[model samples]
Target chain A: MTMQNKLAWPKKITVCEVGPRDGLQNEKVLLTVEQKIELIERSVQAGAKIIEIGSFVHPKAVPQMADTDEVVKKMKRVDGVEYRALVMNLRGLERAEAVGIKKAKLTVSASPTHSLKNLNKTPEEAVRGFAECAKYAAAHGIELSGAISTAFGCCFEGRVPLEQVISVVKCFKEIGVSELSLSDTTGMANPQQVYEYSVKVREQFTDIDWVLHFHNTRGMGLSNVMAGMLAGIERYDSCFAGLGGCPFAPGASGNIATEDLVHMLSEMGIDTGYDLAEGIAIGRRVREFIGHDTDSSVLRAGRCSDIVIEQ
Target chain B: MTMQNKLAWPKKITVCEVGPRDGLQNEKVLLTVEQKIELIERSVQAGAKIIEIGSFVHPKAVPQMADTDEVVKKMKRVDGVEYRALVMNLRGLERAEAVGIKKAKLTVSASPTHSLKNLNKTPEEAVRGFAECAKYAAAHGIELSGAISTAFGCCFEGRVPLEQVISVVKCFKEIGVSELSLSDTTGMANPQQVYEYSVKVREQFTDIDWVLHFHNTRGMGLSNVMAGMLAGIERYDSCFAGLGGCPFAPGASGNIATEDLVHMLSEMGIDTGYDLAEGIAIGRRVREFIGHDTDSSVLRAGRCSDIVIEQ
Candidate 1:
């Protein structure tokens, strides 16, 4: 596609598949560390460059992801692919750092209530926790990516003021954090909110790369993604088949489905170096593995061109 | 809520729920007429004014919607609700008319191969058939709404020429179609195509209402809906729980899920006069009634705010 073609439309955007970590954590079936590694390998083969391998949360709290270290250790490190792991606190950061994990994400809830319930800390404490985690990552030569959960809105608190998100971003940036992700932890984000929030973040911090983490809990995941894309933010986190929801976060759903996101981007003629059908197929396999139907519509319904006209 | 709030954004964006018609027809387990009627009643209650309740297709061909007459007969007629039935030809139109359907939608495929396989007629023959259906509807004091399926692009034919869609729109207008719906029958539409196509149709038929029928096959359904909405086309079709697809249309899924569409519109503070939570609940009820899950993500995961956070 030429520049005019690119400008005449939204480019086919690259997708970051977060299914292995974000998707599996919410499942009732606890896949073995081998299964998690296999899932990551399949996702990479399916053309996922950035994959969330696992979270370094307490095994006691999230038994499903108990083998995060083993899974990450055994992961086949592709030449160009980036491996990501989620860390919630200083201890999790230490666990990731100990595993030689080079890149990890730190999440803090914007809503004080969610922070308390989910992390056993307040928003301020969570920010402090990130500050600590970022410091630890820096000392250990790991890249720290901070995500403000409930940046768009919160389930417990209802509406999280944009000021709170800005403050969180400001605090994170003050500690030399250059990569940030805005999360709709409860999926309360509308397109306008996404646009306004994204624009606000971009205006405040021009140097940082901001990724959007949206949930389809209320069915606005793709719309929010579009709004974020239109607002000039590119990186987004999606799960295959729109699966995975936090068992702790009430009403939280799987992130936007990777296949659905890729489908949209591919249709826009943006090159993601990914296969749409393969993405859907992998999503279905994951769905079968989990033994539950996923929320992704595209996985079951193939692309428009897949229509078979019977005579 | 208020006129100021409603007009604060775009006003009167038409959302036609095609769940009863488009959504149910694609399911393996066919719903009874009573269940279909109940779904339609809830749809109208949820502020769907234009409901595509059923189609007049052959029973053997689409056994899922075999009881179109019974469904149409039992549907509660609201004062402003414009109920529509899909008609593929003169025979379908006669059946729709016999059932007292005041508004009948006639479809002609833009892709020749699809038209031949789907309707066993050439494009010219399908157009002529719609023209005759229009005349018949007019004589019977019913309105004819003409739709061109695969207008954006076809699965078999690949890229559908822009002129082909425009020509069909012109023919429908010339035949005095008060309304026209351009369908991405196989989900071959992207935001750019949606934008370009709607602009083209608007320029050609300034007097006719252009309704868009999109499938979320590639996950661009809502984006295309927004693009069309921005292009000044208000009326569009959706399915409850995003249910519906042409069994013959191969990879096509249901139209935009009604709850998700309404959720997007309502959250923008646009007045859809619909309750998002209620729509999802209705979708759930229908899922149980049909004994299968619908493709709507919102139904499985309620709104983020709807989550009950136990203290």
Candidate 2:
């Protein structure tokens, strides 16, 4: 059978680097502000147009991100690159706006069990909190992108209902949040689920910007990306060195490696606007800085175009 | 915006275990004959219908597979599971038949440069050798499967043209070989290439069985499998513990992990008739036997359905 008409892939995609925020928060080592700044700057040099620099949560809660404020203060803002921070509450939003962060991402868990455990709030309470933060950020001239965590499935509540996720997205929309992200917090999504759910969500939220955040847990990260792309998603979140796992999800691996994702996308004739080699180098450096091996495959296996030169 | 019609995935697939041959050939450690027998037995227990037990080559060339004859001799034959060995020439076929091996795989390189470096023959010469082996195997009541190495791309010759690969397939068909496999020897294949090439090959060889062997060299192994499935191909080759890399390609990684493939397939609702947990256990054992970490993500992340119980 002729399959020329079956495959429909996007020609271009926007990859957001989330290594400095999500990656570092789950890391054991506490990078200094300078190191965090270096990572963000290097990510920009690697052609990342958007970087999630840090999260504005309580320092005592996540000590690894204690210097997030300082890191943002010292970071070199490159032209045309949007540096965003994650804000959980109104206080976090205030701190981000004070630091001159123009774009802030507000997240709430879709599953009540995960929300209670991670945020000490029910799903309703978390959504209410996000509503307050969204109002504050919008009034303060900050662009807000809302994220629904555990959108695919939750560790505490296995197989989170798609109805629950749709409700959360509806709440985000009700609160005037136009950009939204669905996070596979436990990496429990398969390609079919991703494709089916994304198709439904996109149909429901016709005007919102849809972003996908997938974990490499169970090894379906890039496959989920492909499914999302086929479902018409254009923005994705990845990390350098495949760093970061959900602290609440046991045995979770990192986010998809930025270099690995870029390598596949670039080879498939999709434009990612990132240098795969440069991303690999930064991933290696981050691995060294944290004194741990990363989950990146591209770092271990060079690019497909790499010529094997014999000595 | 509704994409429910574009994606076409197969409902069932056949996975062949090749860790015993392709996986072990590039390993530093050599398994005892008993250990090799146990692995093959475990693969059968894990629902592998076909297992490549060993390769009949010169012992000096690949010492890791030196005990091929002993392994086939001592292995317990399981009903419904077909055990096969790799035979490169008429002599190798004779050795396999002498040991009462019922099925054998004959391989030739599609690229002349790789054929010279790997088999010390031109592409035509290797095909001629495979033709001879096919004749002998057919007459001796042994089922033969022909594989084209470097069928996607080659390290020495760069991109092996699709015309070159098609020519090799034509030669295999002319030799009366109906079971054929195309190997991405260097792991240079992308999803688009796999989809397009597989569609073309399936169109030309409507009655032949086609198998895809991919390496995770650029981390596209499982994605390529997805592409192949979308293109209507049903058979794939995977290795336990994601073991094996090309000895000729400097930066090649292992074949797609059997457990990883099974995990994705099972989660996607595709039946491979394999127990994913059992396959993971075998992969873990193989990792211990080799005293090295594997490239399997499911081995690290567990299955998507695994419930993370909070401490």
Candidate 3:
């Protein structure tokens, strides 16, 4: 049966796993570099196409991600897979380049308040510095992607201007960053805002590969993903076992759980190229390894196909 | 801006709250009749147009609902609000009528295994008994609605036949019940199945007022709601603080939280007629009263508009 809707639904989509970088960073239980490597390898076995292994941030700022250099060096890399790392600036990119990393994402925040609090630089200042990283990346033969935090709304500032978000995209465009991930830093995006912004950004930047990253801080993460897909987006970023939360947004949930997102998309007949049962097992394992309860509904309640007939 | 999607969206829709009945019955904390009344009155004051105040099930079956009769008599009834209650059969319907309840819903399980375990009858036998309740309601001047639990799938039995659910609806039609609630008791429904089934049922039962009830057990509750909306169905059933889990499904979550649903809809410009801030406060209060954490995201992260600027 053909499905008709106001929006075009893609047959398949890319789900980028970022549990090691975005998820583990927020948890108090620090994982060994070996465990982080295990998580990344298992994600690849579960059919992950793009994986964000860790970040090259200041060790003092994010202690959980201090071992990024080791993780990038030791983790098993697959030939067809795109392993990504979050880099703060040119210095971080240099660190990644030293480790022979192929793909690094440059980060900025659209909310000026968030930019000041998290990066100690305004959003403008942050993107302006991306130019240097862009030049270095072009010379070094390394691929670079761009991510904008608080692209939809901000925790410190009530609402972020759409124009501010657009300006970051414009900078990324001029600096020749073709891949962009617009993230809901504090999970403040609603489906409508997401749909509108997705449509607006894609309309103007027609050649870019857009990835939507959302935090389930307020339970609208998957719904925002739905909105993004309806707006013709085909790539998303998620965490295993629902493992990430914004440090600034206290009591908020993490990124949309990879297991739950795969479950939903698969049922909708949209392929994510991930084995769900394998993913569920990994989600449960991560929660157990973390020695705490996670926010994963799939791990708690098994997939729809798991049926038990009682006497 | 005009919104266009594959489905037609209603400018406003009714959000039927079942927290008082469906939510409280699953909780270990037994609230006094006075507290139940307070919850009901507060819901009415918070712009709830339709609410399931309590149930008429046997005390042995659901001890938490044993005080339902007392709740029905003691609660302050507001004008223009449709206060609803659950009933097992004619006997339960008689009890609701004695207290002058204007509306009562008779339920049957679409899953035969669920029917045998929960109601001690098959799905076919369950609906046959509803005929008596329908006759009694018509003669007594009370309105009757039909609800098919486990309509989508069952914890005991994996996938329920779409035809079986339709047969129950046909039985309701023959008995003159026009408003029906099709509930995913096990939260085993996917968005595609929900959309296809919703469209099919509406196509066949042209005059029926369809209300979609979903559980957040597997985290697809709101996504299923989106599917139904995309299928042109309006009314939805939700619980406050995301309370209520099926006893049969071990480790499952409860219904989709009312506050979260309202938050999503209001942001999309679809009016649910509820005040979000007040709803969030009530959700937090429910968790406090029950002395446990709930599944409400808005309570934990606040609304999109609730911003706190850090120094």
Kindly indicate the candidate among 1 and 3 with the higher lDDT.
3
Question: What does candidate 1 score on TM?
Answer: 0.86
Against the true structure, what is model 3's DockQ?
A: 0.53
Estimate the TM-score of every prediction: 0.86, 0.95, 0.95
Off by over 4 Å in 3: A1-8, A116-121, B1-8, B116-121
Which candidate, 1 or 3, would have the higher TM-score against the true structure? 3
Query: What global local distance difference test value does model 2 have?
Result: 0.85
lDDT of 1 at B291: 83
Q: DockQ (Cα-based) per candidate?
A: 0.36, 0.52, 0.53
Poorest stretch of ten by lDDT in candidate 2 chain A: A302-311
Give chain A TM for each model in order: 0.91, 0.95, 0.95
Q: How far is A268's C-alpha from truth in model 1 (Å)? A: 1.2
TM-score of chain A of 3: 0.95
Candidate 2 CAPRI level: medium
Docking class of 1: acceptable
* Residue A66 lDDT, candidate 3, scale 0-100: 93
lDDT by residue (tens digit), candidate 3, B77-168: 88999989999877889899999898998888898877888769888787887888888899998888889888988877787879989988
Q: Count the backbone clashes (under 3 Å) in each candidate.
A: 11, 0, 4
